[model samples]
Target chain A: MSRHQVRVLVVLALAAYPALYHLLTQSPVGVEAETLLPRMDTMVALLYFGLFAVSFDFISGYTGYLSFGHAAFYGTGAYFVVLVANGKIPLVPSGTPFMITLLCAGLVAALLAVGIGLVSFRLSGVYFAMITLGFAQVLYVFVRGLEWISSNPRDGASVSGSTHPEGFEVGVPFVDGLNLAIGPLSGDTVTLLGHTLGTNAVSFYLVGAVVLACYLAMQRIIHSPFGQVMVAIRDNEERAEAIGYDTFRYKMGAFVTSGFFAGVAGGLFAGFRRSVTPENTFYFLVTGDALLASIIGGFGTLAGPIFGHFFDESIREFLSPAGQGGGLLPYLQTRLSEGVLSAEVGGLTVEGFIEAALNGHASLYVGIVFVLFVLYVPNGLVGAARDRLGGPVTEKLPDRLWDR
Target chain B: MTAVADPALADAGLALADATPGSVFAASVLQTGFFAGLAEFLRPSNLAGVLVNGLAKSALFVMIAAGLSLIFGLLGVLNFAHGSLTMIGAYLGGLVMVVLVGGATGAWARLGYFLVALVVVFAALAVLGLVVEVGLIRQLYDSPPIYQILLTFGVTLVLEELVRIVVSFYGLQPISDWQEALGTKPAFLARQTTLGPVTVRGLALFEILLGALTVVGIWLFLTRTRYGLFIRAGSEDDEMAAALGIDVRRVFTVVFALGSALAGIAGALLMWDPVWGASVPLAAETLLPAFVVVIIGGLGTFRGTVVGAVIVGMADAVTTWWFVNVVTWTWLPEVTVFLILVGMLVVRPQGLYGVEEVGGH
Candidate 1:
């Protein structure tokens, strides 16, 4: 098939999965509740993040310099979008539509990326890692202070002050003791290009759609001269510099580009959730997740982070072994139990014993596995796939799982 | 060399310089700054109380971060899951203490409980560290340090949620039974020493003594022995050291073991004194400062770790004392540390004492 055909097919496949998942999980098809509407938005947000995360793969994984501090941009966008959506911008009368909020989120994140990328782009490897990590942490802490902008009452606006607090103090009460304004909400049925599409399914599809766009953009960059320069920097900076490449600009571009997706993801997250809080954004772990996905999926490979992202999200749930044998063993146990039942020998049942053995302490096991993965499989699933596929190291395989 | 020679003297001047000034200082330092300022701890009687608490708090952080610094300096792996390790140890240790207190029918059982629990923490952590080394860190040994860090961080996330699950099942949070169990013997500040109303804790003496002993043991282990020399050598240039007939692989495993053991030991001690809960996310807090200490004091410098820990401990103690409730400004602690780190980075990037090693570009 042609590249465009392949791209269309890829989009179809991705769009179909969430709908399929919804079909399998949610009873009855597409009769959404008001509360459930948020989930649709949230799915969109995750899709946005997924797209952004894949974009991150371009700079971090493709370039081989991992940054665990992108949350600065991500969180900045999330918080900024909420501020903009709520009309939290000073001298502005009120909030904007959710769409506008999303734009502001991306713009602000991209802007912040430019600023941070300027500073952090200088270092590489561990030093680069530390610089980025430190800056993100500083930013996370700084935003927590911006409680006024995020969801603070002292920002000359309160949800209750805007509308009225029924029982509590303000608007929609958030997780950590903050409330939102009643209704300056500028939402107008989730739409795209004047099409009155089914938002429930389309929201997630839009996420995939955006992700595909990001993937293509990233592909273009990775193949472009600038991107090749980034790879050169990653491989051998000294030689690159000696051969005379202003590697700094390349690094900055990658950093900012990586950050742009994260910001987009953050904005989507805010619009999806309809609120933002320090609890969600001000965490180093969130940044870690993106990095983990990129690494595990395979560095510097377009298809790597997608595999990493989905695999990470899935593995944490399945292999966790904490939540009652949720992964492989549980499926086996269910099937096995269909045939017969075991009598309790001691104080514990067979089920209880199995639960205690595996599910009881999932983190302990997950930790062991994570450590084991690093020790054994450094290049992650994508690397393994590449090696087995028997192609040139950087080129895609015939039916490459990572590639579209 | 001042306190380097006399460990006892080192404990005094570093009584923590509470530089924030008065009540504003106290509030900004501790979450309980309000109660302490308004009533319980601000009185003349409580000035001694504040000093005693401040000293103890400093000592606790210093000791915990010291071991963490050792591990990071030697291994270059920031075990993000160290705090969880500490938390697990504290929880288990507290359980033993509780069982001992309740079922003290025989003295053997009581003694057995303490010994067994100590062994449990140390052994568990050592094995855990080994597992991590063999499983994750060993592979990343050749990759960029970020891979190592992220891998550990992934473990930390999974482990923390798992811990929450385990705790919820066991009917506990991170810090519930620790205070009561460890603080069984009420330790008030001894009123004898009248140096500006700072009376030291009887327990504080024990902590200081232990800290000194640990410092000495580590010093001897690294400086006066073959294995110690191997450790120092490996930290300097692992490839060259391996080339020179030292089993660098074995050294990596051992260092991880030793480092993890130290973390476990710290957890055991922390559970009894101050670190029973998740509130003191000891790993993250101690990890940063310890890394800073390891860097500033000189990476992999055993002597440097001590000096660095002392600096961090005193800073933490004084700031914690002066700020918690005193300043009521959330940004102060972070800002203070950021400033310290920035200053250190500008003047001494390899750390205050660290000699940049090979393998890290």
Candidate 2:
């Protein structure tokens, strides 16, 4: 299938899931379709991957500047949106729409990127990467010092019941087929589609929309003429300069664009989770996620992050034993050991054996996967798929991942 | 957008005015090519309270930076987990010490026990670092440098959570009977000297010497030793070094080990510092400041890192002094580095003394 076809299918699939869940199930526990979306954590995981993938794919994928501090933008946006939602900031309005908040967040982070880019752009390669990281640490410290930023964020905590705590309210309410009774300027309750759709579903859908919007915009940037210039500069900076293409402007432009998308991702994340702390907002892991997405998905390709997001989040989730009885290895054992009758056909229940084999190291599974991916499958899912298909059907994508 | 590789290379002329410590000498120091400006040495209590703080802080930076520099230079791979490695070493060292000392018998009673702990730290971390290199980092030597970061990053999260789990577990399951019934308190100074205008801790001076010795030792190891030559050769051209019959793989594995050992040493030495303070079971402040010192000095330059460390240490002391005694400034403490980092990035991108990665490096 072509890139466009895959995109259409993915979108249609996402759109269909919630709608189907809406009609079939009329609220599980005063619950609704949004809350009961299959693997809600997986959806959140997708948002996190999508955000970084947008910005990282631009510079790392397109421009070839291996930045180590893209999290600065995401964190900045996250802190701002989080601060506003918690009524911590005086400059911004509290409890604003998630979309408006995302724009503001993007703008703020983009502004910071502009300021940082102005001074640090002169240093090329490793120096630039280090400078970016150093500056980010400074930002991290700054955020950590803000007592306002810490608000015990519910890590995508689900709200299935009709009655939430008095303090709990969805800041960005996606009210449809259900009435949301607002108590003046105090708190807003979301009765999503027939059931009282809790804050989690509202935040999840809000974040999903923001992440999708950012991803689409980044796709456009990847195909833009200016973005092409950024890639040219990455390929051979001096050559681009020699060819009279103002390489500095291209690099800076990419940096700003990347920051803008990163901010959108952050804002959405902060608002979605209904809280933000320094640990959650400014994690190096978040930066790593973006870097991994770019590397694994195949750099300089629009479809790469879409593909990379699936692998980085879904595969890790598959490996992870978070509140689950089995992981990929366990499932594998069951699949091989029990075939469809692993419990019924294989005629044996071996959940305990699988657990014992795991040996209490969930991260070990994640680490092994990461190491193997970098070493053996460096071009990532997109690259591997492209190779198998004998090059990209899209003109914008490179035959090789390192076209930049 | 302001994007420049080295704004320090392109001089940002933001001059100061009036009578202050740095104002008069600043013109000649920054404007003139001569390295004439002194680091504004200790004057208040005569023993370098500020200077010693600065110096010890420099050592801290040197400890982490030297390891980071070695890995980056030799392997041509930026160990993303270097910071995480420092954190791991610190927590591990702390756990060992706490397990020993926090027990009824006390850790200081058995000095040999401490030595054994050091050996354990070295072995464990060295093995861990090698595993990282062989398992993940080895592939990037032939491939692009970008993937090394991603791989290390993947490892970093796994390790951080693992350490968090381990540390949290140690709290639940205290090391059983770690105390060896040796009521020994190792030679930690209960002495402070008031000399001339400097107020110095006895331990501070020892740390300064240790830092100096480390720098001298590292300098010799890099420039004068055979291993040092091979490291330089490898950093310059790994392909060439390998072709010249040097086992680049072994060199890399050793470099990773040495780096991990240095981080371990840093974690151990930190026990004697003032920041650890009176009655804290475990401290996390060490790693936060470690990054500051690394950034203040350019990444990869050991001596520059020492200078950066000292610069921050003194700044912290002086700023606190100014905040408490003079201006009553709360925000000035954090701004010190913000101002300094911008000044460093804008004025000297290779740090004060970091030799720029010459040519291919």
Candidate 3:
């Protein structure tokens, strides 16, 4: 398929996800779809992460400058949005519009990127990587000490008007009709297309739309002429400089762009999570998640990390405990106990094996898969597919993954 | 290590060495105002405690950093999983110690068991090192340097999760028991020995001695042994060394194993000393500091690693001692280390002992 076709297909699919998920989850006869289909809230959360990873891919993937402290922008955005929305910031009063707060969050993150990039861009390679990490840690400590933001410094402030107190009600953008009543808001049901949808189901569509918009914007940036310069710098900085490209300025631009999108994702995350802590917001490991997603999806492919994150979250959902409901492991365990697989292998059932593997070591499998991927499949899932097909059919997508 | 690496560093080291404690202290007060409130904040007893504590901390950093430096110098890979290896060693060592001495009758018997367990842990890590090199690392030597980092990172994740899974599955009580015993201030390591006005724990002194011994052992091996020559030569010019009828590949394997073993010993000592008790997060937490030490000291240089460790370790100790007492800024300790790390990178990106690589320095 051509690049345009694939992008259109992806956007259409994302747009249809809520309806498809709703329908697919509904099982035959008496079986409830709730168990089989992930909860709407879960889907929304996955979309948030998908967006986050996609933004991460925009800079690190294109420029090959692995920002180990990317979470600094993420936390800044999350904290800013939540604080502004909750009337914590003096200038930004309480009940500020969510979209405005979100935009402001992105702007703040971009400003932060400029300051950090100016100092850190001087170092290259591993030194650059460590310095970014150090910068993030400094931010992490700073937020952890601010007790006024939240009553507890360690556990940071939450959106006061979130789902808990009904201090705010989220509705369709620009539409006067009351939508998903969150926190202590309103009625549980939202009527759409002659069907009454739960608040979570409405939330899924709302967040999904935002995520789709962000992804498209990032995709546009990735294909722009400026992005090409960023890629050139990644491949060879000296050559880029020799060509009179002003590689440093181009890199700074890419960094700011990446930060802005990452901040948007952070704003969405705050909305979904309703709370933000230093550990959850600014931790270095959060950047690792984006890196992991980019690697798993395909570095330098703008949309690959989004797909990677979705795949990751789905797998995690499948293996999670029974209380979550509809977990594949629990279902497998039940089936194995009733079937012949339980009797084989000297009495240790397939269920036991699965249990053993999933017993707090799910990440081990991810690590093993990562190593194997690096060794055997450097291009990741998307790149390998592209290569096998002899590259993208789209003229817009060059033979290379990074090429627009 | 090699003609003093950088003369400026050598001069600074010598000058600092030549300065008397009183003079240095007075200068610090005058110049940086670093010791302005020292009289109010630190008593004689507190000073002794911080010094002894700092020495022990430096010892730990040195042990971990030395192995990391050796591997990076020889293999040209950062070995992100180095901390995980140490973590594994600590867990294994802790388990063996508990099994061997958990049932021992007397203090002497327990001491013997502990010693035996440490040796066992070292050997185990060496064997693990061999397996990792032969099976995984060897294939990636020709790949991009990032592959090595990613590979080691994956290995670290796998090992960390594996440790967690194994402990949960096997109901590994020794792991938790060791933590608990250490938390309660175990009788075995509770006693302190007073030397000249400074009271120091026997375990701390032993760890310090071990650190010193590792330095000497590694220095001798590097300077006097044939294998060490191969390692040094390989690091400098692998192709050239290979052309000269030397099995550079075998040298890499040996050096990697030895480095891993050294990390294992450090991990085992940490378990006994209860410094950040062995846990799943140990691998993740120890990684940055080790990276900082290697970078600050100069990549692949033992002397640089030692210097970096001291710089980091003493900064941590002094910051903790001062901030915890005077301002109660618990967060300053981490900030101090980060400041040093950033300052070093901005001033000397090649590190104190390293030659230039990326050209900034």
Please name the candidate that would achieve the greatest TM-score relative to the true structure. 3
For each candidate in turn, the TM-score is 0.77, 0.73, 0.88
Task: Kindly indicate the candidate among 1 and 2 with the higher lDDT.
Answer: 2
Q: Can you tell me which runs of candidate 1 are displaced by over 4 Å?
A: A1-6, A22-45, A91-93, A97-100, A145-199, A315-346, A349-369, A390-404, B1-58, B103-120, B154-166, B174-196, B199-205, B274-285, B322-326
Clashes of each: 34, 31, 4
User: Comparing only chain A of model 1 with the true chain A, what is the TM-score?
Assistant: 0.73
Tens-place lDDT per residue, model 2, B1-361, is: 0011111111111121111222222232233222211222222332245455556556665675667667765776666677667656655555565566643443346445556556777677888888888776776776656667667767765776566455434443222211221112254432554446555565566567767777888889989999988887887678899999999899999898888677666655554443432111212244445555655575555555667777876676555433322232233455565567756766776667655662122
lDDT of 1 by residue, A1-404 (tens): 33345456656776666555546445642332211222343345446556656766777776777776777777776766656545556643233444445555677777887876776655456655665667676666555543355334122222222522221111122332332221113222334576443544544554454456667777788889988888898788788889988877778888777777777677666554555655466466666666666666676677776766665545444444533323544554545673233547666566655555445354455455555566667677777776776753344443464555
Reference-based TM-score, model 2: 0.73
Please identify model 3 stretches exceeding 4 Å from their true place.
A29-38, A161-164, A167-189, A333-353, A393-404, B1-37, B172-188, B358-361
Model 1: how far is B270 from its true place, Å?
Answer: 1.9
The per-prediction CA RMSD against the true structure, in angstroms, equals 8.2, 10.1, 7.5
State the DockQ of every prediction: 0.33, 0.18, 0.30
Whichever of 1 and 2 has more TM-score, that candidate is 1
| Per-residue C-alpha lDDT of model 3 across residues A199-315, encoded as one tens digit per residue | 666666677777788887877777789878888888988999999999889988989988998898888788667779998889887887777777888877877787677766666
By summed lDDT, the worst window of 10 consecutive residues in model 3 chain B runs over: B1-10
CAPRI grade, predicted model 3: acceptable
**How well is each residue in B1-361 modelled by candidate 3, as lDDT tens digits?**
0001111112112111222222222242323234544663366665666677677778888987888899988888888889899888878877776665553256666667667767998899999999999999999988767678778877887888788777666665423435632432235555666667556676777778888888889999998998889888887778899999999889899988988898888887777764456666666667777888888898878889999988887777776655434333335667777778888878887789986752222
For A1-404, candidate 2 gives per-residue lDDT tens digits of 34465567667776555445546455543232322233444565566557767686777677777666788888888777656655556766564555566678889999999988887787766556666766776676555433233422223222112222222232344553332222112234356567654443444454566567767777777668887788788778789899999888888888998998888777656544545555555655467667666656766666676566766665555545535533455445534655432354243244533433343454555565666777788777777776776776343343243355
